[model samples]
Target: MIDTRRLRTLRAVADHRTVTAAAAALHLTPSAVSQQLVALEHEVGHRLLERDGRGVRLTAVGRILLGHTNEVLAQLERAGADIAAYTAGTAGEVKVASFATAIGLVVAPAMDTLRDKEPGIQVRVLDAEGDQSLTMVLDGAVDVAVAVEYRGAPGEDDLRLFRIPLYSEPFDIVLPRDHPLAAVPDHDGEAAPAPERDAEMPPTPEHDARTAPVDTSPASTHDPRALPVDTPPTPERDTRTLPVDTPPTPERDTRTLPVDTPPTSERGTRTLSVADLSGEIWIGPYPGNPCHDVIALACEHAGFTPEFAHSSDDFSAVVALAAAGAGVAMVPRLALRGTDLSGVVIRPVPGPKRRVFAAVRRGAERHPLLIPLLHALQDAATALRQAPSM
Candidate 1:
């Protein structure tokens, strides 16, 4: 009998194309990954891998086994789902993996809905990028993955996954508050984020000087990755703290759009287009992030490639860099929440929305723990749809 563990190792090897990468994903040493592959080869009586330049490639037989491996793993998921359904495990824990932006965008709201509706069910969330989360879902490392569309991943119609649409959000341009396009009249230089969610930047002379700090919030979450960005508080800025406990609402828009009062001068007439930004220094998501792909493709489609001068996956850092004139950035609307946007301006752009979705193994949606969770996620997405974004 083929060891499923070895089969999973083989699948990881195939997916990452390197022993080092596969081992890192599996939390094993490269020597151990190599040993397992050797053991599996001995058991199957065929050469499963070969060297190519600096990397490894699957042998023909290895590819054939991978096909079976997918089916086998998927069937195992089906069995687990059916068993959970049979046992009526509705109150069991559901593990979720999601990108940081999606966590703020939809998952946090979903968790709230689940908590109110199904008090007994437990939900655990892990922050990961789209590609990493998708792999976690496939490997049974997590019950659900909230992610953006990534290259070379299974699609909606793929036989081994069940996808639930979450939300589609546009990428808004982040420009310095002093940019030429921001010279509009009437409205004061207010940040584009919703008023209730605005974070006060306590004068961080140290944090401010860095074009892009590792983290950018003095009131940062307990997440270890979020370092403190504190500077001495200034007297000129309105130091009043925004209410933290108020729930979000669509009717409470504080943005002073030209339509409300009308722009008097020709200063507010400039419009935004991808082609209009061809020569600007771009601040973008780090490489391998799904948002990076969106920005890169949008620029390419616009007939020019942007030269990214600063990069960060954290939306706060990206906005901070943009605020400091490092470059302009493209950020999803939801991600702008809780970020310091005091020195930034937003000009809405078109198309190329970053669509978020919930994914499970092809047949695992039937799992009792997953049913309420999926419904809760969809419900949260519906609420987000009803809410307005700038």
Candidate 2:
């Protein structure tokens, strides 16, 4: 019989594309990973990997074996889930991996619910990006993962995993409060009507933008006024003046703006198109982040590439950068919830929406911890859907 551990090592090598990376991810030495691969090949009586310049590539037999390995691993996962269900104990530790925002918007709330309802079950949360989280789930390093759909993410019907969709959220353009594009002009030259704000509430404080700490309390009932564009400008304020020409300071001009990009004009309306942001400097996620690809694709569709002046993996930091007048940003709506918007103006842009999902190794969907956890996520998503947008 093929050793499951060796098969796992093979999968890791294939997924990471390098033995060194695979070893790191598996928390094993490079020699150990190589030894496992050698053992796997001997057991199967086939050479599974071949040197491809600096890296190794899977042989034809290796690809065929991998397909079977995925099936066997998935079956093993299902068998474990079935046994756990049959044993009927609610006590177990479930490790969940997710991006920063989902931890705030979904996982944290679900954990709160689970704590109240099933104290016996312990949940461990790890902050990870979509692709990394999914890989962790497949590797059994995590019991489940909360991930977003991206260009290279696994399809919904992938046999090796089960995906339970949670929610879909559109990206919003965040601008500085003092930005010329923050408000639209009224028909008679007065400011456009502002979205209603709760006068009794105080402004949320600007916290460190790098971390999104989970708030266990229910979402605040008090809704802030929608993008406030109603404040009339003074006589000296020309609503049409663009901030783009503000001299590029060392801190602000991190990257050169695309040559063909147009300059921002004060002439646009409240409703924004992707094309309208062509000239603006952007604050975005670093390369390989799912949001980074979404932003890039959205810009490509709109006819220009975003000129990223600042890059951060943290959505909070991205928003903070925009609020500080560094650049505009496209942020996921869920990330914006419960965030401080004191100096920010959020407006909808026609672009890609992120689809969030709960992923597990195939057949683990019905595990006791996962079932209730899934329900809690659904409840949170429903509540957010019903609640008014920030």
| Best-matching candidate per lDDT | 2
Best by TM-score: 2
TM-scores for all predictions: 0.73, 0.77
Model 2 — TM-score against the truth? 0.77
Model 1 shows how many backbone clashes? 3
**What's every prediction's RMSD, in angstroms?**
14.7, 16.4
List, residue by residue over 73-160, the lDDT tens digit for candidate 1: 7667667776776786667788999987668757888888888878878999999984888888866689899988755667865655
Backbone clashes, candidate 2:
1
Q: Please report, in order, the local distance difference test score of every candidate based on alpha carbons.
A: 0.67, 0.69
* Model 2 misplaced stretches (Cα beyond 4 Å): 186-190, 193-269, 388-390
- Local accuracy of candidate 2 as per-residue lDDT tens digits, 256-310: 1111111122212144677878989999998889888998999999899999989
Q: Which residue ranges in model 1 land beyond 4 Å of their true spot?
A: 28-32, 183-270, 338-342, 388-390
